[model samples]
Target: MPWKESTTMEQKIEFICEWRTGNHTITELCRSFEISRPTAYKIIARFEEEGYEGLRELSRKPRGTHPNATDEMVVGGILLLKEKHKLWGAKKIHKLLYNDFSEEKIPTVLTVHNILKKHGLVSPQKRLRRVKPIHPIFDPKLCNEVWSADYKGKFLMGNKIYCHPLTIADSKSRFVFTAKGHYKENLASAKAEFTKVFRKYGIPQQIHTDNGSPFGSVAAIQRFTRLSYWFIELGIMPVYSDPSHPEQNGRHERMHRDLKAACAKPSAHDLKAQQRRLNSFVKEYNHVRPHEALEMQTPASVHEFSTRPFPEKIVRFDYDSELKVLKVTRNGSVRWGSYNWVYVSASLQGKHIGALEMGNGIWRIFYRNVFLGFLATIYHLGQAKLRSNLI
Candidate 1:
């Protein structure tokens, strides 16, 4: 005789009434009620404690508030800060909360986000799916172990001139070295800005960049542009993200999102004014902003200057004694195996490279210490033809 689902309250009341008669034993009553002994005894205990009211349906709702519930005062602080900095997210707000409240009083980043979401203040953004990192070889363990540089997409200034922003940042510490504004993204402008960076911060061992003009060229040998060659001359290896894959340079890209929001929306009237804005952004980004990756510390607090200073004179590559060395011709061709001119790359013109014979007809090419590609000397119809396979 289990209690009917539709009339549980009536059945419970009837059982309590029947139990009070004392003629039926608790076990006998339990059998009659078709309920377990524990359940029967629980109902009996509730009736004794609270009388008829206890026999009525007990509230399934929880008692009082949860012990771990967030305080209304903290929620008020988060809402106030959100209204103050409309663009900022929970992490930044949480960091700012430290100014007014103790660490114990402040909510976590997730908690702040949840509060915002509950209040309908947070708009859900579509998550962009990312690809695997293209080059997993370079994992920078220290400051200046590597540095990333890229030209953010060009935008029109108030004076109608297109401003291209070239940004450079340390990979490990996330310190922005420079955010230079240029009329165009060309070799001269890029080189000048980099020279300033190198002189100030010292040169990094490796510089990471996207496969684009001034930094790289897919058509050129080993994707080396003239700027890249200059880097090699100064003992800095130039690395590139895979073509069309922006996630490989995700940290730098993330910084660009902030930069765009802060500076580019309502662009400054002129290049000089825009430059001032950029300078302000650099100062704020390095000193004021707290990075979650750096344990809520500013980049300036984490970054250290690179040890490799800019050299006064560029050092020439010293090749192994066994390998044959050849200088690239003015026309970008290297004379290989008697009269056959192998076109290496126009970018490599006037540069000396070494060739080590790997096997039968394939020769391994080297520009400085970097492996350029394969140089295969093929003979067809009694005529020897040199084919350059540039990586």
Candidate 2:
């Protein structure tokens, strides 16, 4: 009855020592040791036949070698391909060889890994820790409803400075619209690329990005940057990932990985060469690469230009009679009453904002429909500090 997890040897010793007493029945001994009758018998017989060594556990690994395993000639073939394309991984190698050899004849990605390890071409990898998924919440039922945008980290070209890549993709289809190298990571360069993508593919309902510059700001209220304000002006809602959580925009991050491997590993000679590489990658990724999440279909097959075409000119915001409208001055302050002045964002200078009441004479402000911030409009002398909270 003293079943223990001390060691395999300890359990076996206990079982044998108890069995030697010859007082208990087989079923009783099996139950006492927390083992089946068959298992108990097998252990007893092994100890009797082969002594203490027999009680030790045997490997469950297959005794015979794999039937379709690569022999010396096939190993030579793998090495030859590896020598030819040194950077190609096992999966890529397996995909390459799968066509030439019969499915049963060619080795799998795992087998390829083993061969590489046997040859000292690769080291054994440590088990990766499992992390919780931070998948972005927006699920577009159809293509072009939600789009993702991010700047893939900068890399140096043959040019003197670094080049930042601005990548954009359709959320539903995973179609990468563009992955252009930028001379600067500032707004002007980003807007130029975005304008081209907008003009080409049309506008989406929302654009998801991380809480970073160009797309967002840390100091700004709601982290809405001027670039995001522009997106809002164009009838696009901007969504942001939680801070330090890259996996929230995981699909885009995965694309960035492929982009790094394909184009930026050994970066191109100049901006122009990098642009050419990106163009090639985009063509292959959209029209050729089969995405597993997309049921192994190409993104190009699923994506089409959005029906909500980009407007040539900016559309002015309209306020209904239900809300009190206040015009923002050059200094980004609204002259709320004869004496009261509420400050809005400098980005909203010369714009109109609607004031929505939130009870107790506390007014929440809006640039168009976005909730900017709050104001106690009745001018409680004690609440002068509340004005600083408005942006």
Candidate 3:
């Protein structure tokens, strides 16, 4: 019979009394109590050692320190580091511990976490709900294969000016190229910052960004903005994540999160001060911070400068002999069928485009080597339908 919770003490007393009477064997007592022989022996041993005091329920809590518990000195070191970098967690703290503590002396990451947790220094965070990688994410093997850039969401500074931080990082090594604070997200500011980065880091094969202004346009052909067109002119391709899906460019987004935490939470007084803070963040991120993806290696140690140098002057694009070439007018339209003007993007004004006639009144367009889209050349009521779905 299982012992009732209310009658547990009574049952223990009855078992002891029955044993004292010598009426029941150890097995019989265990059977009556629905407990093992070892439990009966333990109860009897405690009774023998301390009489009725032992029969009263003893504390279930552990009496002394565990054998595998972290040493007091090591706990002090962990707490000190946590005090220094309150934002950092156990993994980063564990890595830093090697500077002062030997590998044998240092505790595991979990142990360090428990040390922080025990002292109420760190709170348990809800586990992130993981989702499947539904969208295709491009992972570059080389440093300059792709670079990701974005404007970290605008935040107000102490001086009451809204600061827009533009951050660019190498896709493979996560090496931050630049993090510039701008007054606004405009073409001139973005172009100036990018020119500086391009001249220093050289040109990447491709640049990845979200569907945002100065980088891409929803209405334009192939989502090419003036900035992206410039990339095309430099023989660099521009790529983008799908609209409303930030996780497609998750690595860059993750960096933005860190940037906001480090610099934006306690915003600087002015743009100049904000720029200084960004510079510090870039230095620490590239050189000091150890990335888990890179096996805890710093980004600066892994990244290499691009081989393609930024040209002083952009070379003009030449088309093949078979295609008909025409320059886009100031109004961003081409002369079609001598009278009908097919409207392209105004951003493509003064640029030359080539049109190759495909079968069935369809004409395929191209800017340099990149295919713009398909255009139906049959002039119906002075209107030419442009089909940009091929992209």
TM-score of each: 0.75, 0.71, 0.86
lDDT of 1 by residue, 1-391 (tens): 4566768878889899898888899889888878889889889899899987887776798899988787888889999988976667899888988988888878788999999999999978999798554664467999988999999999999999999999999999999999999999999999999999999999998999999889998777778988998998999999998888777888899999989888899899999999999998999889978888899899999999888999868986799997899999988888876867778878888889899998888888888888888877776654444444632
Rank by lDDT, descending?
3, 1, 2
Query: In candidate 2, what residue range of length 10 has the lowest lDDT sum?
Result: 382-391
Q: Is candidate 1 or candidate 2 better by lDDT?
A: 1
Please, what's the RMSD in Å of model 1? 6.7
Better of 2 and 3 by lDDT: 3
Q: Under the 3 Å rule for N, CA and C atoms, how many clashes does model 1 have?
A: 0
> lDDT per model, in order?
0.87, 0.81, 0.89
Better of 2 and 3 by TM-score: 3
Error of 1 at 365 (Å): 1.6
lDDT winner between 1 and 3, please give it: 3
| RMSD per model, one decimal | 6.7, 7.0, 4.1
Pairs that collide, model 3: none
Cand. 3 Cα-lDDT = 0.89
- Model 3: per-residue Cα lDDT at residue 294: 94
